[model samples]
Target chain A: MSSTTLDPSRRGAHAGTGGAPAGGMSGTSTGPGPSFFRVLNSEFIKFRTLLSTLILLGCTVLVVVGFGALSAWGTGQFAEAAATDPQAAAAFAAQGGDLAVGVPTSGIAFAQLILGSLGVLLMSSEFTTGMARSTFAAVPKRIPAYAAKLLVVMVTAFVLTAASVYLAGLMALPILDNYNLNLDLASPQSVKMLLVNSLYVAAVAAIGMALGSLIRNSAGGIMSLVGLFFVAPIAFQLIPGDFFVEARKYLPGNTVEPMTAVQHVPDTLEAWQAAMVLGAWVVIPVVLAAVLLKKRDV
Target chain B: MIEARGLTKVYGDKTAVAGVNFTVEAGRVTGFLGPNGAGKSTTMRMIMGLDRPTSGTVTVNGSPFARHAAPLRDVGALLDAKAVHTSRSAYNHLLAMAATHSIPKKRVHDVIEMTGLADVAKKKVGGFSLGMGQRLGIAAALLGDPQTVILDEPVNGLDPEGVVWVRNLVKYLASEGRTVFLSSHLMSEMAVTADHLIVIGRGRIIADAPIQDIITGKGQIRTRVRTDQPDRLMHLLAGDGVSVELQENELLEVTGLDPRRIARAALDSHVMIYELTPLQASLEEAYMELTKDEVEYHSLITTGAAAPVQSGGN
Candidate 1:
């Protein structure tokens, strides 16, 4: 079943069971050589093959669901206490007893940390393990490979986070029902929370990738990512100043609340403003990293 | 064909490869010979477009490697055997590389088989022995069936059988009109595998000549002449740049002259010559001579900042 000769350009004694000779099919004819599609395919293969990647993916799902069930039981107990105690009821009112909407995404902060670390590991491992030479060799148009990897990471983060959130919501329904608590999965606020948190996790993953590219060492990249999303906000708060207070708005983790609100929340960015700020958080570092990666030797 | 015009690389204050020019014609194995820090890998990296040159340019088949429509098809390079993700299986590593050029899975399998990695193809590369890792690197290089192949120390950690396989494979590839350029410090390996030699030292090319020419030019081909009239024969054969060393009572080792001249001198003078034996120079000694001052061939002093390796000649 060899030597069918699809294009007359590559006619020779075939080297395999198919028509394509060993050296028959050369480079693609024209139009987007290392196209996004091709690079994406390559990146996907790289992503799925590693045991560490699969382990991280599995951890993301388990944490989201496990935390969701825990939050559900905790919320039910709090609701029961509010009924018996007046002071507890007042505190619950002050906090706005709308805690159910966020229960499904209770583990999102942890999810972001884990999934973001996965993103950092993926890109940094390539350099630390010396895989960049093979990667860059295939796609010398370096940006395409970077873009494809970013696309893969962000999309995986979005899909996995969203699905896990939904599954967590479903699991919580049964647990919350035991305490006669009502949780509407179809509620507008609930849907908004799931979508916004998923998008937030995806953006965090992209930022992680940018850090990995900028710093090719895995420990350095993950530490930088954690420093940006985890440490910076707390550090800013601990330092008492108007500048630190104002600068905290620009931090990537804080943007999720402003963009996910039911109404324009005071002392927080507007929805559109938060969206733009989050976009900048992902784009600015990613672009800088990409430019440096292209210019520097592997 | 691969051509470099003043291909240079400088890392901060130290230059790894200086401005030098050479062309590797197709259909032969060009052995890049040098000691460590001789810029063989740096030059190969620049040629593959992984490292940008500080000055000058190199082209494969009349265009810079990055500019080629399909760079992998034009040239394949294994700069380092560690140039792989350890977490991935050997099969998947090749598969990921193959996917970039739309190379099929069948070709990947064929390359795996060709490199004798079929057994460990499914295992994680992190767990592989050094020999297995080298096979995987070779497999990745051959995935595209490239015209110009560059393998840096391809046999560095191979078993003897694996070494023979690679030697035969590169020679076979060269015979089919592909340009196969490889680098090694083993002069014995280079002597047999290369048709041409490009010797580099301290970021500069020392000699660029055919294999035979290098062995002849830098290496002396001497003759052992056994005769009762050794002194007369030695005097008769003596000329400018020629040296005659008496090994035994009757044996004389003649340099800067060949067997034909010695036979002619003996016939003309009517000296009774019992034996005229030609002694071929080993490539190891020749390589040492070629890189004498250009690269430090350290003496066997026990001071040992780094032990000076006495290769096969030891």
Candidate 2:
């Protein structure tokens, strides 16, 4: 069974279904068949082929573009009043008065919500609909499937968010120019905002994926994501204690403020501390979900 | 070939699949026949590495299923018809699964054609009938051209024509020396399709043998003797363990006696026998005989002794 059997063609051959040729790796070959590269390609294909996923991607773009245009108009109205009122002068100075850089991704919150839900649906649906059986059947290591899906989710989240932000910037240019305010998509500050917001959304999507894998319920996963980003921060504030204030800095949702701020805000976590907090948010749940997935019955 | 050694799955307090070993050899259709909750699906899932077994180990060819580098090429399983995102088109679903193995586009279309899903390939699976959904699932299973094929209740929603198509397909696959492990409670279908069977009840295998042995090995053979004098035939054949039941005033069902003995007795008694047909034990009876006592959880509402009737008559 060692020499003549090692032809690779006949090694793992069971009953031949006998129409198409054997796929890339036949049964005869041994040792870690579906490499990470192959798994990544598989995950990419799974990511793009669904209509629901595409619809969510499309909605992210539309929301970003629409909100940028609206925010441009809002900033223009505020700029006109800054010259007339002393109180408005103070507010305009606080925003740097050239607010067009911020208009492009004013809808990052909604973008996070939609793309995060996309991440949740991608994984949770696999289990809810029984595709996990087929998925795990193909990549039984379980971790490969989990990691591949996470890569797919995070990459899509980054790309879609960045593209939406860019399109929003382009759309906001004319709206901002009508008020004689300068908007530059090429400026260092503008690019930093795009990169930071896109990464923030990517992190949020990863969190959503972890919740989905752990919860395995669509509504439940999305709800948990919402609780983390939207509800937790406000609830922490209303509770009114120094512990809550300190704990709020560690919340995954609070990382974006420190990242996007030009100068670190007073009484807030520094940029490096926030990055570590975000890293922990992604690493812990993802590892836990992967372990549980391998342990549970499909 | 699929081999299991002490493959077991225990969920919290309840034991679903007890420690049991079985081998699914290549070159034949091995039917995993079991009652509703008898752990057939559980075993298949474990084989696919979808479930972590509590103790035992199962291997496809030589290594554990998940350990395979290209598992799709090793095994293709249709665990359920609805194992798909119903929002996606049947074609796209196959395309995504195919992409995972780097299987080409042509094979995706080929399986769609082979499974007779050409018309509905572009349609969303959510709107599909159960039969169509089963066809899609079958297409997905065949996407990798895997060596070993595992199907759970492959014929559940198929029409008679579709069922026949699947039967022929499996037989052809086996003819090519491939391993086929399928589970179905439809004894009649198994009777025609499977070469060997492993009958499981309550997570225990009651009998594992060739189909013929299952029918003939466990019970007495009955011969139907249609005579003009039913009463005469019954009385004539009655002796010792022999018992005859009269039906339709002319037909006598004789058990514990072979056809030759019945004919000899009729000749001696001068009773004219019209139709002397021998009835072999059906798989239904054979299965009943196999599981009559082993049912871990029997239903409270007692239905006919469907198992014993056919087993005893045979």
Candidate 3:
């Protein structure tokens, strides 16, 4: 072995910087190490390249838009019935006669499930397919890659959900017009629904990804996500106890209503309390996942 | 260069790798030869910082792998052929890995071409044959043009031509003063490809030396003898350092004694031997000699069953 060739000073100077001397093809690299930005860029590439992830995103759009049109027609029929029924009319009036505004986000329940599963899949697949080895090898710090992937999953979930919700609203417009019902797309309430619901779904996706990293299996992660967001709430409600009822109100899925509601409904958490609850839901799992990822073997 | 000091890994009660220390220096291809269940892969994973050591430390250059400012540029590894998402195309897999280090598209394409994956680069890795997967792995390992390259079972599922290609590639990398450490269970492959050999078995280091020394050092001297009076010669050659076995009616295989001593014994006994051939021990025999006692899985055979044939001898 050549002593000069093993010189750490010379090698360290060029390592991770990405700035190599001329003819870098000769293995004379001056490349930059895996910075947070670089890892983020890599994660984005991974996110956009998979056909399955793209398909999930497309499904979210279709389901949201399809459910929007259906809900618009359903709301119009109910509004028509309320014209003659006094009790129905009183209930309709209590909603400020703006029930059509809720049509666009009718598919949100399904959106949360699909996008949340997508979140779980992206992280869990790394372990299942052994890709984590390559990923961690490049960024041996491990957490940078985890953070970068989380950013990609959450951002994509937010943008895709928001865009799908907007498209659903647009699709609901003509349907509602045919039924002689009004839906103001630019209304403050409409914008609040769009932004808050989008953010909520993004939070669910983050939680799903955290479960994925922690569980490191697709079915297990998705199942745990469903239990937290779906089954646990229903199960808690059915158990018939004061504690069960109180706990059901704090479920992640239940938090969305309070966050998007203009006024806090009775028996539900206030918007600020709901927001903190949702934040805790996301923060706890994500932090746990990050710590485990850093410590475990790839 | 890579260095390990008392590196160990224990999975529950099973010690996958005991505390073993060794250095893989630059400018040569060092082969890590071991059987299945040995610590080869576990040790390599520790060096890459993928698996935390239960105890001790390993370093690349002068620090832990995770501490390297530019880990990809400093070290690249093909720890497994399947260290990829099968649904992703070869091009995209390499692209994602390159993105971490801010590597250019040109470099990604360069590695693809270098690994002869240009034709299948766009196809999903799920459909790739094992050889193709190995090629893609090599492509990823070389994506950074790293100073140190580590490959585990690199030619595991390759055709003869692919095997030759990998052998030449590792040698070329070493020739350029890069530290090339590769592991394989095939002693013949390591004999020709590696300048130095680190023989491991049952989670322990059995031997570490130059390749040539291993082939010649532990392997005992054996000579093939075809004589008219095989039984008489067997009795004449019976001694502390010599054991004679009747291979056939007229053929006797002798071990532990050189041919000169055998010839002297035969001359004194006046037992004419038609053939006296010295058997040159190949790397395979030397490896078996070193690892025979350390193998983890021993196949049980009945007493009348045929003895295991030792390969790679001339």
Candidate 4:
């Protein structure tokens, strides 16, 4: 049975000798290992094939759109109440009377959480399922695959966040117009918010992937991501020390607000400083993960 | 060809694989046989460059696996059947692995049909039975049509037909002048499948020789005797360089004694002997004798006292 099933001539006939130059030349001498682009393509295929990853991405879109609509309605209510109360009016005026600009990014927090977990799961599942063996066996250099996965993950998170934020703005447009509120989606502040928030989410996803590679477990990576993005900020605020208060401003999550503000808010980081902080948050862990991935056993 | 020079792996306080050296040549099936927890998988992983060796080097062909220009093209390995994400379909899994080396879509489809995974190619691998998973792994290994094939227990969890299919497939692969290195814990399977054998136990090489030599060599001589006066013959055989074990009412298994010596003693002692047969060691017996002292986790089975079985079970 196996003799009939494994006919080499028949199998070879379909293979078409396309890689003969690489295969035959490399038969005695090495031809081409996994180049960066090939590994990226491989990682992208792996990234898109899993149903769980698609489900998580879908949930991110739903949550972002839902929160955008809800925030628009709440802002409309505040604007309506401003006419009857001086304090409410003052608050509305202080908000620049354009609460609608912030509505599109109202669900950025949830998007970061969901996409960050997705990043963690992507890398951790490789180790958990023993897929690392096959992956590294193909590209034994190891760093190219790790870098390729990181690029795939960060790019997906950025594109998804930016696209979802834009969709949310479109969805919230009519809801804000019902209360006589004007929102210019093309306004510089709105565009700044979208780009900065998207970049911030991409950074978070990179950090999550780094944690995943380092920890090699899904739950642990996700928990560390949550602790860095969610728990640390609240815990730092609750602490009484001045150092904690100052350190909170440098957190990756806090950087997004300062970065997107029309003007620098007092007591917050400068835009350039915030960008550098976020860049550090991303680069440090990613470089560390790549080094360890190359050095350690798969 | 594959070569290892003092390859070793140490984890925490324990050494999973100690310093070991051996070479696997091309154009033949080399079976790596051992009991469970014998570092067969670790050695295979090192050869594929998935695990870093502690203080030694292992090279496939001429250079280390990592140094090859195209690893997947030069060598293919199925280190484990579950070395795949369960949520992905079998087809997608092969496609993704193939993409790493720019393997064509046609080749991907070819491997799927070749491994008989065409029926469930679209289904999630998590839902696959063990046999189906093994087939998927084999398909992935052959995706590049590599020159060297390394499989760690390819017949594991396979049905009888699947087992025979793998046996013939590997032999056919070796016949094509490719290097085929396979691993299994089953001695009977290795007896029929492997041309050369490298037996490992407790992370050490117990025997590295041709399959026939391992079967016939290192086996002691033993003769079985059946006598009416077994007690008298047993006493007569009790001497230096002799051991006797009673099998039944009139049967004795005598070691370190030639059949002629036993018969002469039986006749001189007026002990009527009916059956005196010499026993040639089978592969199973030879393997047991070779690895009896090298087994790492010896099961403690006492007649009256009992102990819990350890975690490492095949």
Candidate 5:
């Protein structure tokens, strides 16, 4: 290690300020401050630096592709069974004859779970590991950092999910071709499903980040996300009440189905209503988290 | 220069930092000395704008820390040693912080080498020892080469060499006309390092003055005298504000009187005195005298191995 003495030449113009007016150093900084884009770069650096975060992202891709291949094989077997049994033929007719198109996105459930937990961990670990102090100390306005982190989480989630789903579709092509099933990935319905599912996963990841910020604990944030997306839907179904049945349609997880459906299924929300409800789910928690994060001590 | 005016912080019902005012001037090392839980960390947090003051303001240079165009360039602080993500490597942690202010990569490498973390800069912080963590914290604090530097217990977990390095570093920063505000509970460290001292206790500023003044201000001048006629000397030294305690058979500790006065009195009284040594109070005693009443938790003094018998049974 070098000696602690600083090189005098490297000492900026602020050095030798003993003759300067007392308390006149306020606006002396000529260096760049934390602009939004700079803070966004910082947040991106933080997001990609963790090994655990990268592992979780890799797991999301693996689960999506693995489920896609399995779903394609299962759909081929069912299509072949439909030719032999009248009962199987009736079930096949009920399934819209385009089962292969949905095969790529069959792992949307697991993708949401993994990516959402990742979102929670990213924000929660900041507080848990005491990194918020350094983070806010750099950009004291604080909201920029929050917004930057949110943008990073959402954009990464959307892009990763989209790419993974498309890759899964490519992988499923040969398997589906064995059953003579025509699955066109470039079809409008397939594109809609990919785009909507990617956006849904992005929204869920954002909600997870909001929960992480609000709760500031990894386990608590992930549990609350799971409860909102998984348990609440099942509980609402088993309760057997009109309010819960109605409430189930507005659940953030439930909205993905209505918005991604080929047609407006009976007793489900319209695409616009489900879109609005999902938007509310993301906006309310995000705004609350940002405001509280700004107001609270690091 | 960092200035705090009527700064206060209340957590729920307890006030962590009560209304206090002090200015840390440039070109000197100002030591913030206090016992644990005496509001040193809370006050520093207020100055950093990490914690909002309940009813007052603290400004770095001339404005609040958050209002600076480039806060890192104007002021750098080591609020906590662990104020970093443990899972990240030290280099990446500093890289992320440096990116916020557009600090160049060369400066990041400079701070790393300066702080003796070049060997472990790529290692994950979670596996680092406390000393390594402290070194990393100091590296981050100096990353900005700020005009004002605030470090809370910078040498808490450092080795002797590291401690000496920090001492010289702060002094060097001050020599270049930068403001260096350091906090430590160790009065001995403050005595050797700080040019000025601001002593706080129980969320209050108990003393603020030059380091030498604090060492000799609150404590009385004591003279240890050994004489053949202890009783006579004690009798002769009895006066207003003068106390003479007979520590042993012929040794007497005289307080509130200088050695010259005691010798004069002994010479005039015709009493022989062999030894008279004037005792200068150390900063540790001075600090204990200042914060004696303000210590929140007092450790019980164990006199000996003998147990006291209880008079009443429960």
Candidate 6:
């Protein structure tokens, strides 16, 4: 265990800087540095190595699939009651005659909460545990690491949510079949619901990561995330002004409903408007967090 | 090589590191010595680009650290032992840090073994002792075989053997023409391990010179004398530019005079002196004198009533 094994062969060429080499130590590294792809790889490694992060991902799958099964049974019971009553049948028909399409996504609300908090923890833990010093030291520009982590968080959120939703749909197939209801998982409406919901979850995760970077505390970041996605929606609903109602429609949580709706809901914004609003929700905080991260000392 | 110009860091109303300039040259082990809160860590962080300097600039290899193409390769630093996520395995933490520079997995394994972490590489970092954490930090710093190494308090929690290993390791690194800058409060360790020393006190550079020069520069010559007539020797040896203090009944500490002069005076005065010893200043004493006024926090040594009382009534 001698330091001789630690030495790498030095090259005389200096790679990055143009300044005159210091005397007697003219050698500089010629090996690979922190490119964008390398930083992305590093961030992905960090993302996958945490047991707590894996536990959160596992919890999301269980909650989503488990709720999908429960929703299937409940929707079956509702259809049975509609068969016995004309008024109930009319109400069911008003639901676009497709109660089963929404069954697979019934647990999306909880999925957002779990995965969003995961996003927040990913960034905030870097500060809480003092890993930010190592992280920023490796990529001193700072923005590349932030961008890389954001990409990892959002992509993982989308892929995991999409897979969980699909698995939940698979888990619900027999239950829906028992009620003689048809749910074509490959249908246009179903596909749109899956893709849109996954994208929406990814957007929520980006917002959570941004909040994490800005707050730099796991508890505070997660609380702010919950306040934005959960409490604000409810609080806005309970208030009685048109401004509150209009603002509620623009809340990130509410934007998903409008974008994923089969048709325009009465009180919701247009699908494009919801998409833009969601983009703003992610971009504003993310840009601000990047700016602050660059400016502040680790 | 690392250089700083007008480097300053101010936190609220307190300044951690005042504006100072110095260069850590290559091919030598430069020791940064400072008391607590004297800003050794702050200066290192600024050099590592972890902390933004309030005023000026610090550069490694002729440019700022953030400007380096491969910073890990150009300048590896162990700023703190806790600069790692506790939940991750030691191997995985190094792997992730290495992945940033596209360093190979073999290099990671090599550092792990080199730092004596082969046995606990799979364990979570949270479970590591302070010494183990330090080893991991050193392992990470060597992950890229960096040219300039900056370590703050590298020998802090190490055992005696580990301390010796660090001493040899820094000297070895410097011998390879690599710049090694380490900070420690142990002046004795600095006296032996470093070739050049930088002493900072009260957020300012108080002494920056060769280690030998710092040890011998400010200390005055002194002699200890023991005699039968201590008062007679004290009065007889008293002269211009000489100060004598009676230490005990027959022992005296005479400063600013050589031991021969004290002996000649004692012989001439028939003082019956049995002990005449010349005392050279140790690095510890020199450091105490250098930082005596610059120490930010002083521990009061109460000599009168703070002593435990003897129970005589029993």
Best by TM-score: 5
lDDT of each: 0.83, 0.81, 0.86, 0.84, 0.88, 0.86
What would you estimate as the lDDT of candidate 4? 0.84
DockQ of each: 0.25, 0.27, 0.32, 0.28, 0.40, 0.32
Report the C-alpha lDDT of model 4 over A206-293, residue by residue, as the tens digit.
9999999999999999999999999999999999999999999988889988888778899999999999999999999999999999
Model 4 misplaced stretches (Cα beyond 4 Å): A1-32, A96-98, B218-286, B289-314
lDDT of 3 by residue, A1-298 (tens): 2221323444444333322221232333466889999999999999989999999999999999999989998888788777889888888788736578889999999999999999999999999999999999999999999999999988888999899999999999998898789999899999999999999999999999999999999999999999998899889978988999898888889998888787778999999999999999999999999999999988
Please give, for residues B1-314, the per-residue lDDT of candidate 2 as tens digits. Answer: 78889988898998888987998877788999886778899999888888889998988887888777777766889999879887878888888777666677887888898888899899888899988988888888777776688999998889989999889988876766667899986566777889988877777777687887665643356788888888877878889877788866777788777788899999998988988887765445555654455454233214543442332343
The superposed Cα distance between candidate 2 and the true structure at residue A115, in angstroms, equals 0.6
- Provide the TM-score for each candidate, comma-separated: 0.85, 0.83, 0.84, 0.84, 0.87, 0.85
Q: Residues A1-298, candidate 6: write the lDDT tens digits.
A: 3222454333223222212336544346657889999999999999999999999999999999999999999888778888998988888778726679998899999999999999899999999999999999999999999999999999999999999999999999999889888889999989999999999999999999999999999999999999998899999999999999889988999988888888898878999999999999999999999999999989
Error of 6 at B312 (Å): 39
Per-residue CA lDDT of model 1 for B1-314, tens digit only, reads 67889999999999999997988877688999987778999999888888999999998777778887766666778889969999899999998887887777888888888888889999989998888888888888877777678999999889989899989988877766667899986666887899999988788888787898766643366788899998899889888878999999999998877788889999999998999887665445655655454434454223442232333343
Candidate 5: tens digits of C-alpha lDDT, residues B1-314: 88899999999999988899999988889999987788999999989999999989999888999999888888889989979999999999999999998888888899999999999999999999888888888888888778789999999889999999999999888877888999997777887899999988778887788887666643367889999999999999999988999999999999888788999999999999999987765345555554455434233212312111111100
- lDDT by residue for model 1 over A24-65, one digit each (tens)? 323422222456787789999999998889999999999999
What TM-score does chain A reach in every model? 0.89, 0.88, 0.88, 0.90, 0.95, 0.92
Which is better, 5 or 6, measured by DockQ? 5
Instruction: For residues B1-314, write the lDDT of model 3, one tens digit per residue.
Output: 78889999999999999998888877788999987668999999999999999999998766788888888888889999979998999999999999998888888888898889999999999999999999999999988878889999999899999999999999877766677899997777887899999988777887788887777744366899999999899999998867789999999999877788899999998999999998875345555654555433334212312133233443
Residue clash pairs of candidate 1: none
DockQ class, candidate 4: acceptable
DockQ of 4: 0.28
Worst 10 residues of 6 chain A by lDDT: A10-19
- TM-scores of chain B, in order: 0.77, 0.74, 0.76, 0.75, 0.76, 0.75
TM-score of chain A of 1: 0.89
**What TM-score does model 4 achieve against the real structure?**
0.84
RMSD, one per candidate, in order: 6.4, 7.6, 7.1, 7.4, 6.6, 7.2
Model 1, position B166: C-alpha lDDT score? 88
Task: Please list the residue runs of candidate 2 whose C-alpha ends up more than 4 Å from where it truly belongs after superposition.
Answer: A1-33, A96-98, B218-314
Worst 10 residues of 5 chain B by lDDT: B305-314
